[model samples]
Target: MYLSLLTLNSRSKRALTESSRPYELHRSLLKAFPDAADGGPGRVLFRLDVNEQTGSISTLIQSEKKPLWTRINGYASFVTECKCKEFKPALSLDQIFRFRLRANPTKRMKSTGKREGILNTTEQVEWLRKKGMNNGFEIIDVIALDEGFVKDKLTDTDNTGHNTNMFSVRFDGLLKVTDVDVFYSTLRSGIGSAKGFGFGLLSIAPIKE
Candidate 1:
């Protein structure tokens, strides 16, 4: 019943395009654990929390108004896996992330959902290039799913409320992306609002680092 919301910097959504900051950090344990100094690739600690929201990864982004120009359309959502071949401490809740839960207003509560967190994944990835990656670290590897979370979330699970897979890994990664590639619509009709079909990430958990 609780959905946490995180206004992430699209760029940070490395799993979407580049940089696996968290994954790389996790790999640190094996390469630098017990030797994790300030600048060394040692065992580092970090915590990430996602805010509450609604709708499927596909239902979110209503348009591309960020640059207030380009013709960006449709948002994207996908799972990313980092190839940190080596890990000593092993990625756990402590090393991966401790999810913070929050209650985000549903479509019924908010008015502008579509324009809020919906945009093209490719365009998003491209935009991020201009924004520049500056997390104070180097990126190792990345694997992005071509499909959006909304489309991917309900693919395996029954969209029907009776057997909904509300808790699936659409865009799995170490650090979090502010706009985890989702769609929301507040409009009653038109291109933005889903009318009733909307989705968001839930019960997010990190895999073994």
Candidate 2:
């Protein structure tokens, strides 16, 4: 696996446009990995982080293959810095870490049998807890920050003519690995839904005692 950090010049118009439209940004990021350009099976997960006070913007990308960021046209002009590093984390049962996940939390509607965004803060936390249960980890403490809704046009699916809205929530907290194998898988595949729109990437760091 490879981890990349791309710092973009907020003053660039292109950066401003893509940042606001996650779908476009996702497409732009895919250019770095040619194998994924044709809608291949390669998985690329990313999370955009913005600092409102300093107006700084950076994106964290995790992918199965190494990315050639220079392939993205005009990257040198709009991107201030691009760094990529191989990632391999050692895991063990009962290991604790601080983690962050930008996920589209949702619940299935009993009547419609369709998934709906979960709005309640309490429910959002519960959603993560439930995910942890099945993903081989246990949430020790966590908080959810509402990130509003992400809007994008559906170009590929059957709902191509319409625009879709996905509620976004940011989760930050501490977790303990209950099952190393399962937790490792979760780290690679991510959590929750709407992954294509910058949701479901789980970032973590070990908590030093």
Candidate 3:
């Protein structure tokens, strides 16, 4: 059983690339406190340097989006920590890391392949790949099920109400899964910014061979 640790700090050259939609910490600051400015402390947008499970600094704007494991909002959109706790899976048979993954075949909207019921995990994977990442990545399986095993309404109510409409995948083979950073960044991100990114981690339950 082997596990590899990976970290990212944004490409310095890539960071300097031009951007029509510039990222301003003020965006978050403004959103956090709309009336704090023009008088008192003005507005205070906190850019926390959260150390993710992978030891990577939260550089992108997406570092702020929380994971769903806490509230079960549906599929985690960003990189996810490999949480092996809730899974009571019996992997003795094939000792496989089974999950679902979709591919976005285009740059437009539905480019992330056709989803079975709803939500598009395809696009999410593509977004991460485009950012130049390769953390034992693979779409081991793809189950277009008409039913899911979870419940409704994420804590934020941001996903397809029915959990049935989701793509599941696993990372079990020769590697001990660590964390997964999934999100949508349209080939554009500022220097040291999350741009359109999201990430998270997961604990692991290695399948016994």
On lDDT, the candidate that comes out on top is: 2
Estimated TM-score for each candidate: 0.20, 0.93, 0.20
**Greater-lDDT candidate between 1 and 2:** 2
Ten residues in a row with the worst lDDT in model 2?
A: 33-42
Cα-lDDT of candidate 2 = 0.91
Local accuracy by lDDT, each model: 0.24, 0.91, 0.26
Which segments of candidate 1 are over 4 A away from where they belong?
Answer: 1-95, 98-122, 125-143, 148-170, 176-198
Better of 1 and 3 by lDDT: 3
When summed lDDT is taken over every stretch of 10 residues in candidate 1, the lowest stretch is 181-190
Clash totals, every prediction: 27, 0, 30
Per-residue C-alpha lDDT of model 2 across residues 1-209, encoded as one tens digit per residue? 89999999899999988888787888889888855356563788999988999998899999988888988889887799988999998999999999999999999999999999999999999999999999999999998999999987767766456688999999999999999999999989999888888999999999987
Q: Which stretches in model 3 have alpha-carbon errors above 4 Å?
A: 1-135, 146-204
lDDT of 1 by residue, 1-209 (tens): 11112222333343332112322222222232222253432212222333337321111122111111111112122221111222112222123332221111112216543333323344433322222133111112222233322222222345442322111112223333222212011111112122123222222344455
What's the TM for model 1? 0.20
